[model samples]
Target chain A: MTAFDPARFTRLDQYGHGGRLGIRYHAKAEDWVELALPYAADQVGDPSTGVLASGPIVTLMDMATSMAVWTRRGVFAPHATLDLRVDYCRPATPGETVIGRGECYRLARAVAFVRGIAYHRDPADPIAHVAGTFMLMDAPAKQARA
Target chain B: MTPPPYAALLGIAIEAEGDGPPVLLLPFGEPVLGRPGFVHGGAIAGLLEMAAIAALDQALQAEGGGRIKPITVTVDYMRGGRERPTRGVGTVTRLGTRIANVEAVAWQDDRARPIAAARLNYLIERP
Candidate 1:
């Protein structure tokens, strides 16, 4: 089996799909990390109103929270988001970038807990907030694959 | 104390408030609703979070204003929201110095049946 490498999934290469999706790793801590989403296709809206869509925001929350857990485990653990909840405080501006800071609060045997806040420039006013749980799946055994 | 700037960006309006919980009102528009005519679950989640935050803010204010961060939020979809204006309400279950628990229900026309229900836990950070 190939060894687990966290560097294989850097924010720039993993999240950079092109045109719309753009993610950058701003900082990292012992068990936490901050990600910035400059823009994404899912976040576009009416050009006149400049309202950011919510789909990208949801996707961002899912990915960011998952990354937080991945960073703490220090290995690539295949997992799926069982459930996610996001609160929209307000619509994001069209030109402004949204930042998500996620932290893994607890890691159980099979489940991990994560929470984060999405803001643009002002923390007092968050664009969106999210919290959810992920079900950790152990990497497939090498022998099992063959 | 006023509504956060982000609230304005999302166009959230707090219609009413009471001692227990606060009511938040958001207009359903094409950009927000995921489907052509149906409201997206993500949008509903967003609304639930906003209501929960409002409730948390109120609880903290009463307790002398401190730092509060979200811990976990679980959303249950009960029904599909139509492409119209919807209302949301959040109530506090447990308010402590360290943690605050809240439950919120959102619906459009029928108050008895909720389109979505959510429970959230907030970790309080004292200032």
Candidate 2:
């Protein structure tokens, strides 16, 4: 397996679901990755309150955890989400960019355990917390070039 | 409850279901794609959450209107969402003055074979 390249990773698939949600690379380390979801009117859950929807935040964490998996493994491989659980502690401050940071706590041969928090202004007072796992699909056979 | 931003992003539409809470229909599109051909898990989660909210809203309207605040949600992905219309309906397991528990399932083709299921807990603020 080759080392994970942040530059290439961000550029390769820039128009997937995560990208469409306005999720962008924020920062990353050896075993963790952070992504940001900018507040948008169309993403608001409640217009009166101008609060962002849970889906965007969940997507942010999903992408963050996925990137973290690649970061920890030092490579990118196809994986599927098994399950995800989220706890909304506080409503994310409206009009603020939500930052999602995910860490790969345990990486088994077939599964990876991840936990993350979403926040806008204060990390301590996060908007939501998430815990999930991804199933690593076995390496696939070589694909034919189009 | 109104459709959230994510719903619009995914083009999820509300279809009337026999005068009850509307059913959520997620049209297959680029924004909902995952992997190569399947619907993204996040998109499905978004639909489930919306369905839950819609159901809760209807329930609240019945027992006196109230504000809904999401507290927690657990989503289980059972199968990949194919390139077809996906529908989801939420059921309120218990509606109380303070807390409400809801469950939702999204499926395509056969309603029995759900692509995903979600359980949500919301904090209600009675008017």
Candidate 3:
């Protein structure tokens, strides 16, 4: 097992769904990771309002939480999402990049508790909030690489 | 009604039948993949939300027309989605003047066995 590296992670794969959506690593710490999703025409839920869909924001948070689990463990291990709850506070401003910050608050043997928020320049005024859990694989060999 | 651009990005289409809610179809491809062989959780969630909105839109249209705005959603994953086309549909349980509650489910191959389910709340702006 090795420490999770966001820079290397992006350079390795460029064809996954996340990559196609332009989700990139913004910042990270010991127990949390922040990812960025740039607003694009393809992500618009409403052509009238030009607001990004709730789905893309969900994707951003999922990836951020997945990476946060690895960062908490200090290794890139395999895991699966068990459940997730997302609350949309408001519509994201069109053309503004949405930043999602995921934090692994608790890590047990088989599960990791995670929470996150999506915002623009200020996290205090978040556009969305999420809480979820990931089920850890028993052995590293059983990892799914998500 | 035509789906938005985000629906196309997820490879989703509305399958309307006789007097029933529309079913959303998500085909397996590079745009929906996670890891290598499995579908991404977020993609599945996206599909569910789309289905929910479609169902709620139908309900609201009957009463006159209104704007649908998402409030919250909770998704529960039961199984890993394989490399296959997934189907999702939403059922609006309650439609009030200001709020609506919808339930959505995503399944592959068999409807009885769902890969994931979601509960969503929306705020409606009446016209």
Candidate 4:
């Protein structure tokens, strides 16, 4: 049996970049997860417009997808990002909370496929679209929820 | 390279520059740490991105300057960023009136052995 709990990472007490950006667990379900990146003045990329940096958005998507992998397997297996692609649809509106929702579409013996979108205020018009893959670095016994 | 606020948040700083774009250095610390003794992939990508922007900006300056907007970025993580200072550099491959292509690489120890690298495409708006 694997010692994996979805709730453990849901309300993550993350440090480092995630902590610096104030990333919070927003929502989650089987094989999918959503994360929140709060708007902050320091997070602004364009000082003139107060818009967020794309790099932070990329960071958010990365974490969202990484967790989605664990959620998909129902176990927290060590994994590393193999590659990630981010397509900016448009700049995020200033002073709006960006929500990133990532879904694990496929899982192979050693890889996990993920896709996600980030939106502010309205989900209809996303700020960015992301596609990525992760490689499992460790073997973990997957535990199924009863 | 002058560090931006995002770069500050990631604890990245300008290491050196000579005729070309400046090299960025990310100190290994709590702010950049990921998965215990390993650097977060996101942090590595962030460093590469700042480097890319710095290169793009320098290239545009010589051409009377313009606004650079990101279109897309593809980052390939080759190896884990270890618990050590990481260095990154962005090289502009092509600069056009309306578009620019940039490549960036991050290495922990040897420059030849990269931990991660990124390719960025930007849309340019001339003033």
**Candidate 3 C-alpha lDDT tens digits along B50-75:** 99988898889999989888999999
Q: Candidate 4: misplaced stretches above 4 Å?
A: A1-5, A139-146
Error of 4 at A33 (Å): 0.8
- Listed for each candidate, the true contacts retained, as a fraction, are 0.11, 0.74, 0.87, 0.67
Q: Give candidate 4's TM-score.
A: 0.92
What TM-score would every model get versus the actual structure? 0.53, 0.93, 0.94, 0.92
| DockQ of the two-chain complex in candidate 3 | 0.84
- Count clashing residue pairs per candidate: 5, 1, 0, 0
- Residue A30 deviation, candidate 4, in Å? 4.3
In angstroms, give how far residue A24 of model 4 lies from its true place: 0.8
Candidate numbers sorted by DockQ from highest down: 3, 4, 2, 1
> In model 3, how well does chain A match by TM-score?
0.89
In the range B27-47, model 1's lDDT, one tens digit per residue, is 776445442466655556667
DockQ for all models, in order?
0.08, 0.73, 0.84, 0.74
- DockQ measured for candidate 2: 0.73
* Model 3, residue B99: C-alpha shift (Å): 0.4
Off by over 4 Å in 3: A11-13, A139-146
TM-score chain B for all models: 0.90, 0.94, 0.97, 0.96
Global lDDT of each candidate: 0.67, 0.84, 0.88, 0.84
Tell me the tens digit of each residue's lDDT in model 3 across A55-104: 99999999999888887787876788999999998899999999999999
